[model samples]
Target chain A: MIEIVNLHKSFGKNQVLRGATLKVEKGESMVVIGGSGSGKSVLIKHIIGFLKPDEGSVMIDSVDIANLSENERYETRKRFGMLFQMAALFDSMKVWENVAFALIRHGKLKDKEAKEIAVEKLRAVGLVGVEDLMPSELSGGMKKRVGLARAIAHSPEILLYDEPTTGLDPIMADAINDLIIEMKKRLSVTSVAITHDMHSAYKIADRIAMLYEGRIVQTGTPDEIRNTDNAIVRQFITGSAVGPIKIEGVTA
Target chain B: MIRLIELIGRFVEILWSTLMSFARELGKILLLLCATMKQLILPPFELKNTFKQIIEVGIKSLPVVVITAVFTGMVLALQSYTGFKRFNAEVLVGTVVALSITRELGPVLTGLIVAGRAGAAMAAELGTMRVTEQIDALETLATNPVKYLIVPRFIAGVIMLPSLTIVADFVGIIGGYFVGVTVLGANSSVYWKRTWDYLEITDIYNGLIKACFFGASIAIISCYKGFYTEGGAEGVGKATTGAVVLSSMTILISDYFLSAWLFK
Candidate 1:
């Protein structure tokens, strides 16, 4: 299980996350939902040790990861994988190389072995024949698939997604949602996804949490989130501007 | 007088702020440098990627570097022949051409060429990655940015600059010889012999050393500018320009100090 306990993070005077607490059980998919600038990404960064929390701790597999040294972070990260918003594919590397980057970097496999594994992972993501193509050559959905392939290539126990479905069309988003579900079912991995896309949350989440004003306002099952009377959750989930979320900076 | 005083005060303030920021950023760079050195020494040094980067920065930059050097060489010989003829010192033109290029022009022109091509490219590429959150993605993946990105380029720059300078210096000398014999109506033997006599290992070494420092300065400044780029497209563009300009100015300034020490 992964746990975030009393996590606080601030950038200067602007507090991003204040005492934000959450947990996802082993073999669980927990989707975090929030409006724009609601600190979801900051929370993910803190969990990944890319940003240290000002106070409190993020415990992964019952270890306090926030206090780990850089080497320790590397070791800890061996158990984790992530799909970034832009897909973050290393443009310099070909598709197979991108998929097998960790394998090559850590010296866990030889070139031939890594290539085989990369091909297998690409196949798992439904991208078998495109191994020689560059990230720029892939379409948006294909890039995300390749990103997913690379993320899970190492068989991480934990998978994190930052706005995984943001740039995809509706059908592609649904396809990705299906892929996420299929991966979770097969690997029994703990998945934590941060996004404003409620359709994705509804599709992949076992439990949904709404982050607002730097704190998690509501945490419950998907049905519970849908039926909740909280105005913020309603405004966010229903795509309505009638309630608390202001429209001056955001389009929807 | 009032306006001048006000302007001077503001300038000092800006200087102070810049120095303060430089000190802070320099400290961070030193720490990052230590981390990079550590990773480089350790097993699994990512040799494949480093070689790729070398090919990208050093080998790929050749055409521009050569073109610029040849032109500068031609121009230098043309200008100097006019001045040397007044003193009837036209035969010594080869000596002067070889010396000036070795001591200053080779390193300076190569640095400028790289500042435009490699340096700007590094800044923009890294800056775009910075804005696009790819660097952060690397961090999340437990890839050290300095070790993976900056240090390889830094090492490559230090290694390649002198080699590039050698090429530039060689091409430049030949350019001078061509101009002197063909265009300036000078004896080829006199030009080549003077050049050989006037030039030595020390002059070549001095320029190579200058190039080492020049390459380091450009890589460091460009990497720093790009690594911390914020905002969007405009911010990335500004950072690339800032890197090239800053790298050029620092090379010129550092050149003076290097010359004083070398000559002394």
Candidate 2:
């Protein structure tokens, strides 16, 4: 469903992504595992047409999204729903309003209909009776659940999760992982998630791709990744400090 | 001699870069203004959001604008009375207060107040949105952040600053009247007559025109700073400060050019 070829991005003198490339099949859950600042977010941003690459193209279903006009890009984005790392709920809005935002704004649904759908999606994400509460009133886990509810509210064809399990307790993170699995099953949509949490990645991803430096270093199933011979992949999965992957801002 | 020449070269280089940076920022601000204008005229007018912003930017700012205008008028009256007393020109105090409030003080004070109040709030709110990724989330939901977020605020600023200035002008004139007639013991009829005779409709309109420009500058600059905010919480703080400072400076600096053009 998505193909990123030879993608390169630089912020001034800092070169982030260099020749990064990856692809994901439709209706499959693809998880990208990377350390912090590995350009995982940059890669997904390109897919969503949020950022144009300094080089190469991001193709979605055969159309290069980078080349689309602003209006056309907005049209193409309707198929995507993203849950940000911070949940990124509109603090000004109620939980239900946040969930129903795309529905009322883009889908042009009536408020009553939108609210009903928002409530339904919230329930699906195991959240109930917190619809009217503001985002500031919600717990971190609850916020993530609300974000998930919002992401799935519009019935998007492609769902993107950015560090969905981060900043939550182990149990909450695992719950989020389970929710990701449940969402994939229920919606049958293509998903691309980026995270450094190996457990969450293993649990939710049908296929896992490891992003290193700025490029995809390896792609494999969870079992294959766990048993891989590649030193970088093995070191990453094992959570070893001593590895070929140099820890940024640290002297070896 | 060689060292002096090197220092001169370095200074020139620094000056050139600073000028270039200023020009670049100005260009970006104009581009953002153009984008906002395009979105505003296009279909899907966010009347509801615009009204909401109008309330926030105009109605909420009424008390401060009124207070500032009243005090400014009173101060102007008191100062002019004292100064004109020396020349036996006490009768002209009303004319000075009315002319100053209507022609300059009303819009400028209102603009500065709104920039500090509404403009700072805009920068902080949008900066928070940017940092939290709510803006990106909006984009993913197929909404143009510019159209959804900026255009309404822009419309509200353009509409409300002038409305606030009108209120400021009236309240300020009344304030001058109160000081001149009741407190300062000037002739009530003389004060009213002089104010009416000297303050033209064109003077009021000129201030209002300046108000519109100030309003546009505040909204666009605030939105620009907030939209491009990076580096998280500290960045939001910096953007808020930059918005208020830049908007106020723009109002004051542009007031000169606007006054010269409109009054001339």
Tens digit of lDDT per residue, candidate 2, span A149-234? 99999899999999999999999999999999999999999999999999999999999999998888999999888889989988
Sorted into a CAPRI-style docking class, model 2 comes out as: high
Could you say which candidate leads in TM-score?
A: 2
In Å, residue A112's CA in model 2 sits off its true spot by 1.3
* lDDT of candidates 1 onward, in order: 0.88, 0.93
lDDT tens per residue, model 1, B57-121: 78998988888788878888998999988989898889988998898999988988887788898
- Which regions in candidate 1 have their CA more than 4 angstroms from the true location? A247-252, B1-19, B22-31
> Considering summed lDDT, which 10 consecutive residues are worst modelled in model 2 chain A?
A13-22
Q: Against the true structure, candidate 1 has what lDDT?
A: 0.88
* Candidate 1 CAPRI classification by DockQ: medium
Per-candidate interface C-alpha RMSD? 1.3, 0.6
Q: Positional deviation of B183 in candidate 1, in angstroms?
A: 2.5
Q: What alpha-carbon RMSD in Å does predicted model 1 have with respect to the real structure? A: 2.7
Model 1: lDDT of residue B132: 79
